[model samples]
Target: MWSLALLFGLVVCTLSVPTGRNSPAFAIEETAEWIRYEGYVAETHNVVTHDGYILEVHRIPYGRFQTASTAKRPVVFLMHGLMAASNCYILLGPQNSLAYNYADAGFDVWLGNARGNKLSRRHEELDPDNQKRDFFDFSFEEIGKYDVAQMIDYVLEYTGSEQLHYVGHSQGGTAFLVLASSLPEYNAKFASVNLLAGVGYQNYFPSLPLRTLARLTNTIYASAVALGLVEVAAPSFFRRGDDDSIINAVPEDEYLSELSTITELLRDGADDSDNSNMFGGAALKQIAHFGQNIRDKTFRRWDYGLLENRRVYGSVSPPVYDLSLITSNVTMHYTVSDVLLDERDVLAMVNDLPNARARKVAREDFSHLDFVAALDAKELLTDYIIESTVQIENLRSTGK
Candidate 1:
């Protein structure tokens, strides 16, 4: 009876129209609603970083089906990719959601939203709206340094665990790499690190337009910053539309066919009507940092031009992030069809890391977005994540 009721409720929720507002209020409410409907425990915590940005974190201590146990469970930290918040992990619903799967497996799950996104928009002294430049002054470097470090420390303190497992998608993985490389001491805090379609060296961005944009990113971002537009939506130019936009530019038949293909890849028979809300705002500098990586073909700190670079780093160019400093067990998962991150870049990253291995996704058609939204992600990605966790536990028990 309960199962039938849940099914009915799900159908009702799916049939309802999602709100079109792109505010944090809607995102928070939607996340909470889904958590309750799925019968999961939702806890929201505000973590203040050393740099003054306040990040909003979401946690699912355990699945609804799990019984309360006195034994402390291993904790897993899941971070979202570029232009996405912690809600991405939970957007796929309970049966296929990575967060729910981790909780059901008896692992404590924590999801982190990077700064400038809807969830982590607050700061100690700066207002995001009025003080645009100060609010959005950071790039992925700051995210890795302050945001990731603080969240990990808070989770460790909250869970009373000596070490935790980390699973990062795209920029999430990049931030972890930054954290591990820049702050080598934090390497001891992680039992293992899993990077899903994570990129470090990005010389092979598959899209022609993106490659072209990378060349102009510095100019574009600097102009935007100068114009007092710091907080901007990533890929904001091509969201959804019935005319003029990329989606509308395609003919009706071709667009429908393409939509079908994408829907199949992401939704995998699940409703995707609410996916529009998943995308949020990010710092312009963050996007520019990625562009810098593409143009320079090196995973290094953000370049503030030659003059400013010398002022900041005492060098004419930014220093490269030393991947060798990462001593934690690292596993990378990539798909051949990921346009954003090329296989060559992934190989280059793997070659740099002292303790790293790379695995290609099972499907050749898997794209960058599939890591989070694919229907078969459980078999292709989540299983590997679970296996990695088990391996970490076994290694710990063996004193290795």
Candidate 2:
């Protein structure tokens, strides 16, 4: 439940779902086009995972004011959370968004779209909308296992860099832990990892109403999946649309300007003929995976129940994702008011992570959406994160 995105997404499901993943209207405006629209050199890269999910990645090779340089800029990969496409990072526009801010800071920025989103919906042998049920048979677990792993390798290989800085929000961070824990070798591939309200443990979800809702949603999705609800696509009511105005929780006093910016961005995207969804698409399993965590109160693997667990894990229960295995330099950002992530849960994750620390957002009222959507967020937090990554790179380059 991405409070900001999901809340509005629920209301804005009015943004008509395209019958297919690759509708002509859907494919026209991608993250790269958004990047180029801002007068930056944007490169679109199609990275195929081992499992054949072709991920759509956008790159800002240099800053808006600066041209490509002989000196190779350090690369920073920005991943979106569930129901969000990479566009979320840039939708706030230049100077205010993460993708643009990282570029303006001279680091090569890569915006990543996970499978099931509008951008990365293509798979080698599956049609997402043509009754290919297996196409939707994945959760964040598979996302971490295949999607994140392949994208990371592709970025490193393309840039000829040994490691890159990672900044992921919510399920984005969840996928990183999935990769690092499942494939421990990938631990060495990061200069640093930043999780914005990164969720791995949910023993103490702050909101009772939302948690109860999540439990019901989880059961509904899981039951549906078992009964051949594998292919979750259009004509579907359970869709996530990306209009942030669906966010009704932001504190009135603090977010007037930021909320205005959000509305304006919505208007710009709403052409008479084009009802582009702010969020792309995600599998029901993705929601189910998070619901499992909220229900089970652990940051472990998917709970396939008894029978499927035996077939999948050779046991009656799924294995846990060991945060201890994620040895990368990790920084977690949490807020007192982020109903999705409690401070206790964040600390538990911090304790479990072998090499990790935690940062609390000063705005105790910061919503989960504020981590990604608020313009004031960078000043409250991300600026320091950017500086820290830069310093780490400086130290590495100088062999300090």
Candidate 3:
């Protein structure tokens, strides 16, 4: 799910992509409203980052059968991946959706939407549509650093909860790592963390077209910067513009169609074919950040070139995230068939963190999207995570 295909699909599919492969998918009417329609209690909380971006986080305070409470149950904060909104959690309905299941299991569920997505696009200062260049200048560094940090602080303060149980999929997981590693103080804020197809350590990306697209995006971004057109959407860059520097390089290989996962990819939480809110939007800088990781094979901060890097980071290059700083217990679950994030990449990330481990998805044929959208995800993955969280809570309660 954390590939250039998804970046393009999320950033362009709904706007200017051709009809067949990269077309837009169905978007949910409203996340909270949809949850309420399903006989569940839903709440919306708007959190402002330190940098002025406002994020919309959804909450399922209790189960359909249980009463809503002020006393506070165990809190589970579920964050979505790149180009996805918090709605991805409940898209499969109450039965298969992880958010609904967690709520049903007596846990307070908080759904987080990253900045640049539809639900969280508002900011205190710059208007996204009016000031496109400045509004879109940030990358995931700001996300993991300012956005995730403020959101976590807000969630804890709002619920009066001391700690949270975190579950981050793809870029969400990367955000967690960014927060934990960069700001180690936040590590103890999470009781447990589960990363589904954890998207850091991209040294072993398996998809060729995805790799090609990453390079192409990087090239286009550089060219755009040189041409004073910094904020680029995939539609503008991928289209056959007269500037052939980045145009004629679109991957048209026959096997490229085999990577039809783009069809399932979400943009603005609407790509689910059977009435879903799984797709979401992203910024061009966010896409380029991941693309840089794909090309350089380093999970470092976004590169700002030599002069700007020294000015912004006080170094010649971006510093790598120190995984060793993440002292909280983290379990990374990877599906064997995930085309974008290889198992080895997940394992390598696991090896870096002192308190991290890797768990392969039980389903052999599980793809990247299956971690969230699979029909049997509860049985295959979330069930185990829920059970594990239960055991952890029980141990804490018993002081064992």
Candidate 4:
């Protein structure tokens, strides 16, 4: 039995889902184009991590472009944010995205899926079907230290490069900070780090409705876990499918209806001619880190109950990491419109890094997902950043 206060709070969460009308209409043509663009021919190579977890590595051909070969182009390891997969860089609806852009620009691209995601769900001797084969014994801390460190080593070994560059979006960015703090030896292996819409300081942004819900829900989640309703923490989106929202303590059918309502909000008034879902379960989890980033201010980590619960919590998020000793050459990018992570909080993380700087995107109305989701990323964002990054790398190289 649920209390009225808890029920009402859940209602508030559903009602507040932002409508699609608020955003500029997504272009159907662009969506079609994105659907058609060629992704790198990826080869799967599995690596066993120090902790006995297995990670799936997708290696895109490095020599497809001449620029990468001629310049001895540096290898870049790409890590997706929370529940997302490596596919995110490929599906931005026709606008040339970073995944393609970096490959086109001659850098060897390797997109990493965090452990427990659909693609990276593997352990050495454990069967996923076994009841024991659920989302357990994992958190972002494991990702940052063991998963990332191993992937970094694998990329260097695969590319035969002594050093590599890194780019992490949202939680991906946070993971590297964790890596730096715990496995500082890996720092020497990376040349630079590009943090897109990162999270480290929670106090820097304005209070949003979702942030408030997170505070409430975090407590609810703690209680739910205690009561053995651990699945409530997983994000409801997985079950909702094309629906609007999830019903707390309700049947799947009713929850599906609410999910439909939320979907309407996400797809409001768009040319019904063009209804495209550019994100997947893995990708959504990747981005949810923006919220978790806020909830776990100052490096506290979260358990993975929210991600594992199939019925209740589709948004089972990983724990927050303590980043007190993250000392890396890091550059953070922020746009005025990124509602998920405000510029102030991103900058505060920049301030914390031993060697860090901040870059503000010229436009304001950008949301957090736009860093990778927007169709115009290559033209509007990454190219500029890459050009400047290369120049900066050059200057540092000469100085050294």
Candidate 5:
């Protein structure tokens, strides 16, 4: 009976549910509730970028266990991976969440939502619904140049700090590399950077499914655009499974039953309320850009085809991002089981960095999603993050 139910649920998710815009509007409210439930104070702030996109940044000023002496703590900025928002860090709930762990350790934790995600979908001059192309014309290049830069500046100015510790996962790490390579002036702004399951070079990908999908990305994106759908959404299994906001949007009993069925296959110890909300929305161009990286095996800017490349870049080929420009003290964390990023690719990325250290997860079976959703993630990764931050702080104080 259980096996039949699980199979049925998988079939339903695979066929019926569409990705992207299926989430509810109460994401912010649910986020607030999750933070407070875990004994942390949550503050939501809107950041307006120079390019006119409005982003939502969440802050945990202090934790319940914090003391008055730790009032003005060192700031730590945490950015999520592809198709994820600030919710990724808090989805595991307070006890196991990285954001809460940072706050408990006396660091002012700020979660950034990149442009076009659920939280940062508004623009100054263009409406997302009315001006689809203009509103969603960016890839990670723009994210690195505008969103990351503006968020770092806002956090620094708001905290009155000269430098803050940085932590990024996957595309978050990619954006940091892009920022350091393009805007080298920001190198001094980070005390230390910890990249988890990050991607730098795409010369090799381990997942057969991903590789196959990459090959078809251009075709799929073109078809979607022709069909009047410009926004791409990740599959539902890639996100949180227990978000109350999504639950509130559906019939409680039916939602719970479906949730149980879905989790049977993608079990990561998440509760029924923990529905996947990883994918908000991404531009068609952004999807194509990642596909290009996978196909070209080079971490370069978007290819505007040959004709447009000459006009925009003065060459037929897009210029490769110079990884050597990233001089910040950096540490990379990867697991052997991550299907998207192979060990060789990660080693290649680390080899290019001027100042870097590499750490592998102890668990041989620790997969990509495990970094955020595994039951033992706190012990396997979050503890290491806390310890590394302390070490970085010590090094800064001693001027090492």
Candidate 6:
């Protein structure tokens, strides 16, 4: 049994690529009305960063229909990835994605939108419409250092708690890493860290199509920046709700067709399908950034257009953050068939953290989207993570 468990961990690390080969075969059906997520109500609050950007916070109260106390229920503040809105967690709500599962497990879930997106756009005294350039002016550093830190402070203040468990996916994970490194003061604010296909180390694994696109686009972006085309941001193609299998009740045929488009590969060997399972347009841009990161073997400064648009004028470009700050005990979970992030890359990331734990999920033919959207994910993917996180939290509390 010990040997099998070790082998499975390695297998999960290997299949983090976007290829459909050797993916998981099971599908999970939704039988419950997601853990009491009331969706975004009219209640709006402001969280100001030390740097001066005001992030809009929307609280989705626990399902009043269910019996649960909001007092000290271990609040979880969720941060979305690049180009993704907090609604990213909404899709997972219908059938009890992590949002539902965690809430059902008795936690007050807080979904956060990074600055510059659709919902979180607001200025202290200025309007985002007049300051369109300020809207797009940021990189992962800003999100990690400014946005996340502010959110953490806000959650702690509102909940009257010192720390809350942190969960981030992809860029969300990157932001958390930055917080741990650049802002070590906030390290103690997290009870546990859960990284879903996050980026920390980017060696050992390669996605062909995406790498090709990054190489090509970086050239285009660099040239555009040089030639006064600094107003451009990465393309946004993938949008939320594109993958309804996890949220709405889409037919299997439609789901497969959409999945094929989103999971299709580009020329260099990465999944370059036109239809992304997440938010559209901007998502492709985010992927393009990841592709570039993989090719460059380093995190990058923010694009001028993004920097200027997001309204961070005269802001110093963030350097590639040191990864050693991510020394908190972290558990990484990946599937073998993920094309964007491969198992090799996952292992590389794990090696970078001084105190990191790793686990792999089975996807004999898993694709990148299968981690969240595979109909059977609740049984296969999420259950493992849910169980693992609970175990980690318990261990943290008990020193087990």
RMSD of candidate 1 to the truth, in angstroms, is: 9.6
Scored by Cα lDDT, where does model 2 land? 0.73
lDDT, candidate 6, 205-259, per-residue tens: 4555445445555555444333333221112211235543222122321222233
lDDT of 3 by residue, 49-101 (tens): 87889899998998985555665589999988776678778767777789999
Query: What lDDT is obtained when candidate 4 is compared to the true structure?
Result: 0.56
Q: Kindly give the number of clashing pairs for every candidate.
A: 0, 3, 11, 42, 10, 57
Q: How would you encode candidate 4's per-residue C-alpha lDDT over 1-400 as one tens digit per residue?
A: 3211122111111111123323333321232233233433446778788766688777664533232245556677888765355656654422355766666666677877666655666678755335221443445567887888889888898778878888898768778887887777777887888888765566644545555545454454445334433222223332333343434444422423333423443333122323333222232222233345455554544434554643344445543344546666788988877655667777767776788889887666765676776655666678876776577568766986
Please write out the lDDT profile of model 5 over residues 103-142, one tens digit for every residue. 8887899999889877888999989878877788888888
TM-scores for all predictions: 0.84, 0.83, 0.84, 0.71, 0.82, 0.69
lDDT of 1 by residue, 1-400 (tens): 0000100100101111123423332343366556656788888889999889999898888777554667678899999887678877876667777898888887899999889887888999999878878889999899999999999999999989999999998889989999999999999999889999886887777766556546766776666565565664423312344543234222422322233322222232223354445555577687778878887778899999999999999999999999999998899999999877889988888998999999999899987777887768889889778877977787887998
For candidate 6, the per-residue lDDT at 1 reads 6
Query: Residue 98 CA error for candidate 6 (Å)?
Result: 1.3
TM-score of 1: 0.84
lDDT of each: 0.74, 0.73, 0.74, 0.56, 0.72, 0.54
- TM for candidate 3 is 0.84
